[model samples]
Target chain A: MVEIATIVLILVGTFLMFVAGLGITRMPDLFLRMSATTKVSTLGMGAVMLAVVIYFDDLVATFHAIAIILFVFISAPVAAHVIGRAAYFTGVPLWEGTIVDELRGHYDLRTHQLESVPLPELEEHLPDVQVLKVLLPATSPLAGQTLAQINMRRRYDVTVLAIRRGDRMITNPGGDAQIQPADELILIGKSAKLDEVVSILRGLAR
Target chain B: MTPVQGLVVFVAFPLLTIAVILAFVRLVRGPSLPDRVVALDLISTLMIGIIAVYAIATDEPVLLDLAIVLALISFLGTVAFAHYLERRV
Candidate 1:
């Protein structure tokens, strides 16, 4: 009787998992795809894990299954959020069916504010040529260097527009400001030159 | 194997495998990084279900451990990939 019940549970779980895959392929947008995957796939996995617990009728397996299910429930949404936010920031266009894009509007407003600022003043306020924001790996050479010592503006023709240290921003940082691991640097410069600067920064400390 | 167990191993697992394969194809052909990441995540979740079915049909508790480990590794991998994509590093 337990065997038969196990078979029934497995079948149902398999069917739901298959449906999740289909939804991922057919969904019109990244958000929709993530929605389908997180909801349906997590449930499918939970069902299958539950089936295993039933098959064994053991407390250990049951506890393991429960742990996995709880982990999935907590992590799936966070992972989806990360993916969706990355796609949005990288300028991946949404499907036409999207009725509203709050992120786009918010970004546009911020860009407009930046554009309104006078260029001369912006340049005067910042020391380094702005390139792109990049994280400093532990191995990067710039990991421990002060802004003045790195001389990024003279070396790579890239300026540091701002420094994002965790949740706080250090705007118009001093020349003596030291770079640290996990610090995100907002740089600005010509595109090709910025790429080189980025490579150099990443290659540092690593 | 009993007829009922056969029904699950042959019928249900195969159907789920087909679906997972389709999603894998999408992961390979995805135009963007996020799309591929999402597809890979879905595939990993589906794989957990497939493994569970195998454990049940065979009545092996060991396979349950494998399923739990796969889930944790897949979740961590997805988060790391997403972070890489977001920072473009």
Candidate 2:
């Protein structure tokens, strides 16, 4: 009777492990693969360890097997979360159908750290709007052209108050003042608009 | 040999071997780094199962110690790799 039971447990455990392996191969995305793998493998190993306890039928062996089961049960989901968070932060693209990305726009590009608070939009009740200083990279389309050519006010709804170029500050520069490769523009606008301007200045599409 | 022992020696080991191979294929072909890491995590989990079964099949109960070591260390490995990924990238 114990022999039959042990055989069944071993089969079940190995079968589930096989299924998990199949899942990791067949799943479309990284998150999906992880979702399939982490939990299933835990159960599979748990069953296998239980079989070990039963088959050995010794106090020491049972204790060790149960310890393994407990350890695996605790660690699998946590490791999955760690890998997923790391992947998301390191520019891993999600599947197209993914919805409700709560972490978007919460990462600080400067520090590469997740912000506790989401990027704040200026309050409508306040009379003052947010101001940000943006640096345009050399590859930026707006780098070689004047502010007039880019239609800064019309397209972006942002004003460039001052241009700081290599210790030379041009205060409220004229429309025809061409931008150079390494100019820092002091911008005044809504936070979202400023973000848009900053992204574009940094040569990002969106 | 008893039927259960024969079944484990013959059937369980082969199925687990095939499982390991499948995970290995994913590890090799995983498109992104994290995908490979996920695969690595799965492979290690399967290894735990294999080691447990092997311990009993050989009747060497002390080998369960290796499974214990694997479980703790594999978790640490995954966390450390994740920490490396975000900071370095």
Candidate 3:
């Protein structure tokens, strides 16, 4: 019975490893490949190690296998995240099928760090109207849709003065301009209208 | 070893070996650098699995020591590669 169980474990582990190989070879882009290799292969190795523990039935071998499983579980996801971040910051093009880019302009290429959106300087003496920088997340419905189509002016009463994307700024974007995921829309309006725009972008209705 | 254990090892070793070779194919393609790194990481993990299978087939507990060291070293190598990918090293 133990032998059968071991064999089953080993077979399933090998199949998972094979699937990970297939995923790496067949996935369209680097990020997707990372997604495949990190989780699938780590789990495969864990299963194979479990089989070893069951087969040998020795304390030392089991300890070693457990240690390896712990290390793999801890490191694999972190490695994938770092690799994905590097690919993004280095401007590796996304696959054409990708509909959203969550980190497009949010990272610094040289430092390999995230760029914080600068909060507008709030001064009571200056003016009542405020300039708000609105960041669009990848899940935002506005993504892949043009500003003209959304008609933010009619919906939220806020004007999109400029759009900041990956170190380039588009001032006074025309009607044809498209709003991409992670785009920072520089809006100028009353604070109440800006609040409404924020809610809308967050996928919430007023 | 029993007949069932022997047969299991015989079947599993070849399958794992094929998986390793497939991962190697991905390593060589390298449409991008991170892809290559990921493939390398997969290869190392696969090697750990292979070593574990060997220990099981041979019934040698000592071999598990080598597997442990290999696993730890591969993790360190992966972390270093991640650092390199981030341009930190």
Candidate 4:
């Protein structure tokens, strides 16, 4: 009876392991692949461990296998979470077909911070954010200048956003990125500071 | 070898070997840091499965302890890799 059970259990476990490998290869993006393998592999390993405990019919072996199973269940999710956060911050792109991205606007490139949605009571305390589209005039003071030279963030506390140059959009422009004539800058910041942001990027600030 | 041992050796071990090879392919082909990390995690989990089966086939219950240790080590390795990635990027 134990032998038959062992055979069934082992086969099921190994099969699931194979399925996990298949998932890793077949999934399109990083997040999808990680989600596929973590739970499947952990469960497959657990099944095999239980098979060993049953087959051995020994007290020590049962305890050891159970302990291993428990540990596997406990640690896999935490490890996956760590990797996911690291990958996201490191600029791993989400799959194109991914819908409902809650973290999209929450990340601030300058601060490298992700803000969680505040509670209803705390929402009143937060600053109102606004996005503005401004065209950099050819004769502007900030033109022919890189982001580092302007010091917009340090001086006015405004984080610059996407810059539409011609038909192309540049998101997360680096410090060395030069402001060009006729480039459209997408500025996001406190609504109260929108005027200041426009004044600075539009070279209206003296 | 006994019938049960023979079954495990010929059947279970080969299946595990195939699974490991498949995971190794993912480890090589994985594009991002997270993809490679997940492959490594899956391979280690498969190793625990192999250890358990081997323990039964060899009739050595003591080897089960090694599976326990491997589980702990693999989890720590994953967490350590994650920390490095978080700081490095």
The best candidate by lDDT is 2
Clashes of 1: 16
* TM-scores for every candidate against the unseen true structure: 0.64, 0.71, 0.69, 0.69
User: Is 3 or 4 the stronger prediction by DockQ?
Assistant: 4
Candidates 1 onward: DockQ, in order: 0.53, 0.78, 0.48, 0.62
* Candidate 3 runs further than 4 Å off: A115-206, B1-4
Q: Candidate 4, A14: how far from true, in Å?
A: 1.1
List the pairs of residues colliding in candidate 2.
none
Q: Per-residue lDDT of B20-81 in model 4, one digit per residue for the tens? A: 78778889987787778888888888888888888988899898888888888888999998
Relative to the true structure, candidate 2 reaches a TM of: 0.71
Write one digit per residue (lDDT tens) for candidate 2, span B29-65: 9799998888888888888888888777788999999
TM-score of candidate 1 to 2 decimals: 0.64
Residue pairs in clash, model 3? none
Per-residue lDDT tens digits of candidate 2, residues A21-61?
Answer: 98888888888888888878889899898888788879999
Query: Model 3: per-residue lDDT, tens digit, B1-89?
Result: 77545755777677777878887888998877777888888888888878777777777778877777777777777778767766742
RMSD of each: 11.7, 5.7, 9.2, 9.5
- Looking at candidate 3 chain A, the ten consecutive residues that score lowest on lDDT are A102-111
Tens digit of per-residue lDDT, candidate 4, span A8-114: 88878878887887888788888988887888888888888878878887899999998998898999999998888888878788888986455654554334466
